[model samples]
Target chain A: MTKQTPLALWRRPTFWPVALLALLWLLNAALTPNFARIEVRDGRLFGSLIDVIHRGAPVMLLAVGMTLVIAMRGIDLSVGSVMAMAGAVAAQLIAVHDAPLAVVVAVPLVVAAAAGLWNGLLVTLAGMQPIVATLILLVAGRGVAQLITGGQITTFERPAFQFLGTGALLGVPFTLWLVAGVTLLVGALLRLTPLGLYVESIGGNERAARLAGVRVRAIKVAGYVLTGLCAGLAGLIATADIKAADVSNCGLYIELDAILAVVLGGTSLSGGRARMVGALAGALIMQTLTTTMLMRGIGQEYALVIKAVVALLVCLIYTPRFRGALQRLVGREVHAA
Target chain B: MSLLRRNIPLLASVAVYAALYVGASLAYHHFCSLRVLINLFEENAPLGLTAVGMTFVILAGGIDLSVGSVMALCSIVIAVLIEQHGWHPLAALALALGLSTLLGTGMGCIIHYLQIAPFIVTLAGMFFARGLALIISVEPVPIRAAGHAWLGGLGIPLTGQLDIPITALVFLGALFVAAYVTVLTPIGRSVYALGGDEEAALLMGLRIGRTKVFVYTVSGFCSGLAGVLFTLYQSAGNPSAGVGMELDAIAAVVVGGTLLTGGVGGVCGTLIGVLIFGTIQTAIIFDGRLSSWWTRVAIGTLLLLFVLLQRALTSATGRRKAQHVSG
Candidate 1:
């Protein structure tokens, strides 16, 4: 890695994601009145920016996990379904019987981890392709969750359980703090440990990584488990916020959002690099864009269209060919002038 | 044993489809009837057509996740033109199919030209199509024109109690064309070559870019046709129509012994796959003990089994190839 100076850091590929987030913030500020305002309403922070961070917390958690997974040249498309399953498990525990709060939270996380282990096993032992292996869960996980909930959206009234979603810390939503904590922890773990280097080597070339004695299978499985844990936490937050488990709609198409956020963070989906902060910034951009669209009274359908355009634009910008073409175009213009 | 090992995937698919049909027939009296058989094809015609397209894209070592959304977009466009804009049904359909093909070509361009992943491009395509469908009409629009209604009503009686819908015929027609293309055409061989090994195919001087774009366009056309079939079946164009349909198409292709990694499947297998899917759905309905959600679970389980089977087959063959080389 190159020596990190302020200028070097700003010129890094990861910096683009943060810059994109800042640009979105500026756009939001311009388009929406008082977008930057933070008021102490009932001792709670209330503003669009705070709301973006709060609403973005779940995706940020997912992106944090997703960044690592994608860095290993693998993807977990089942994360959304896993989220639904986790949320369903939590809601079922709370709504059906008087389960202990600890059990409610622990059971889902454990189950999610187990689900991730299954994905890891399929990929590692069965030697199945990652996309196909995870796809099985993607299709069936929601069905299993529905089975657990008996096809009903189970609602829970436990205030303690709800606190995980709606509670605040120092006038900020508890979810924001949870996201920050998780991001920091995962970032620190990756940055400070040999695991990060192993992941990069494995993704860069699996055969070579194995030859290098990186214990590729174990590292890959661990990456998946970490993603599962993150997804479980996100699911818990979602369930607590709604006070219900919607097995069918909870985390619907969220895999797309998570994957998009990872890609937007300048992490190549083809793998070999991990950028946690960039992924967090990407998540914030998604949240801010959506919040801005909603605030502008744009319909959900239009917002989706805008999101598709943004996704395409971001993808194009990241492509070397597109960048080269743009540079050539500018060069020609300069010469003509 | 070698013969069995060589054809295990194809044989397995054929056996599973047979077993399911036989079991469903034995378990339910009505399921054995000709009317029910015809109804299966009619009900799943759209999925059958979409799977045909999916097979081409997958066989070319790429995926098209936008088929479901493209179908919905086609339905919405056709509905808006014929119902709201008072355009001719055929004209509306032509426009929709053309637009869908254009959309696919655009996605294909991004995939090949920019070298972005197919999944990402098609994912954006999915979002764009679905959003356009919703923007066109949030509410379901009933197509009430006489020509449209007549087209939707086209059904030919097969037996005293059995009738084949136009959509089923269309699906069969598409299936034949896809099968012919995959089995007998140079383009099809090129697709398989591309999927089997992209670098080798490029070195072999295959038109990788054209073939990739062509596959996506074919997928788009099939999706558009499936949309028409769906409109006929439902008699309305709903934006939410075909939600999760792409998964079903992918499932059908995989179950038909089409490797998700591509280059090892054909449309004949896809036909059986669609039939098997329909049979499962029908069995679930006939069982009355399980909810429809069980259908998804069943598909997922089948997909996993097939994927594992493929892995086993590939490894065995790989080992044999190595042995042969060494010997």
Candidate 2:
């Protein structure tokens, strides 16, 4: 009997998503004159590409974390709220205590990490479902953020803080580089080590994985902590981008976008497998779609409709059932005609 | 005792409701008066109606995150028709309901035929419906006609100092109908069956797709009815009126002891859930010192407590069964 190799296995499921992203990139570049122009002046990046990268940074960070969490057969709907909470804490510390720059930055990150640990504990120790556990934070964290901000926007003017979002290195936004480095680190941890294999096995079948002696609880907790850390980083980028902590709108509906990115990256929502490169490509495609629609002067309402329709179509194409039906229909047409 | 054991969630919900009423009465002496009770119902009638519909959907092992947006869309449609097209209010309401039901059917078809996940399908529906609402009217439309005022609280009456709001009566009627369907009808049993196990239900000769479509249609109808009531209450149709209302409905359902996983809940439980939720908001307001943020914190805490309790109950039952087998 013939044996299938790992290369062939990778080629089967991942090929379509990569090709789709490439096509989208080509379409965007062809439609817009300045879609790819990147320039640096006085150590700051300036370009439409940079704008897309900057806008995509927070979402990319969340999606990276989301990919791992989802691979463990769970989802975290509270990442957006976590981002909001982290931003609120950072802003509050700065506004109230006149905390040093380092303290202000580090405090929120610690809070976010703790929040992630809480989620992990509830799911792992208390045996609550992931969705229900995260739902608590999703509902309450925003209120906590609002409370900290006293229902008001907290604005700041600090160049050192803003540099995280606006600064550049080698003609790329600092946030973009940060995202790349983090993505590489996460990718290596999941790929070049045994962690990735363990995660996939657990997602494939939790009971079987447990029988095989995997520390399922530890891995799941680690995944959530990682997600929380990423949300912390995203919060920093978002707060810096606006230079104002608007708790009301910061990171709203972001969970949906991050989930879409993970799904578009060829990761199954039902869990098991994940792809870091695919997620990056997915992030790029989404940003490009949004930028293209804005550049075309489409109304926000219609733009949203278009995005929903496109997302539905992508999901349909990626799903195995739809692919099978399409292949069967093609075969029938060939036979009948 | 057996009945109570089987319906612990319902009993727990009622206990919470009674506690809320008592607490509210103690905090605000005026809250015990019939006038305040009527006012509370009037204020929350729209949400109560939507929650009833949400209850049905959740019981069927699915969710309708688009209800809020659907309500907004209905409100906009009715408002635009009456004000701009010079259509009769009643006719406009019917048309709005029909359109919303059609939208719900479309969603059900996509979920059933395409095998798309219900969450993603409803999320897309939420976006599409919200976008449609914005397309219809970016700003709120005030109802200037005198006749429309009756839609809010004019139709119903009560004894001196005990007036019933018209919206509340409408909500009560809808709740009655939902209760009848869920408790007495074969269709309701089929819905629960579908939720419990789709494959098993099919083997038992239940029409899974039809029941699902019907449930969503009912939910859409409730949302449409809620929109009309809201329009009457506020005396206007705001395109952004129902933002985040779906989350509230879901929260209420969960608190009322409905399993998010599905197959076990009733409209009565949902009513108690909605009352408890509304009471908490009112109590926080009555206390006067607590921040509005307390409402979120309270709901979140309640949700966690109930979820933990559910987990414990299930595990306890599991361990008992294991013991039975071992013995």
- DockQ of the candidate models in sequence: 0.80, 0.69
Scored against the true structure, residue A3 in model 2 reaches a CA lDDT of: 96
Tell me the lDDT of model 2 at A2. Answer: 88
- State the lDDT at B12 in candidate 2: 76
lDDT (CA) per prediction: 0.89, 0.83
Q: What is the lDDT of residue A240 in candidate 2?
A: 82
Q: Indicate which candidate wins on lDDT.
A: 1
Candidate 1 similarity to native, TM-score: 0.97
Residue-by-residue lDDT tens digits, candidate 1, A1-337: 9886566665587788898889888877877899988899888899999999989888999999888889989999899899999999998888887799999999999999998899888889999888898889999999998999999999989998898999988998999889989987988888898888988888899999999889999988988888889999999999999999999998889988899989888888899888888888888888888899789888889877877888888888888888898879888999999
Weakest lDDT window of 10 consecutive positions for candidate 2 chain B: B1-10
lDDT digits (tens) for residues B49-140 of candidate 2? 88998888888898888899999889888888888888878788889899988888888888887887777778788888888898888898
> For every model shown, what is its TM-score relative to the native structure?
0.97, 0.95
Q: Mark the regions of model 2 whose C-alpha exceeds 4 Å error after superposition.
A: A1-12, A41-43, A329-337
Which residues of candidate 1, in runs, are more than 4 Å off? A1-10, A325-337, B1-6
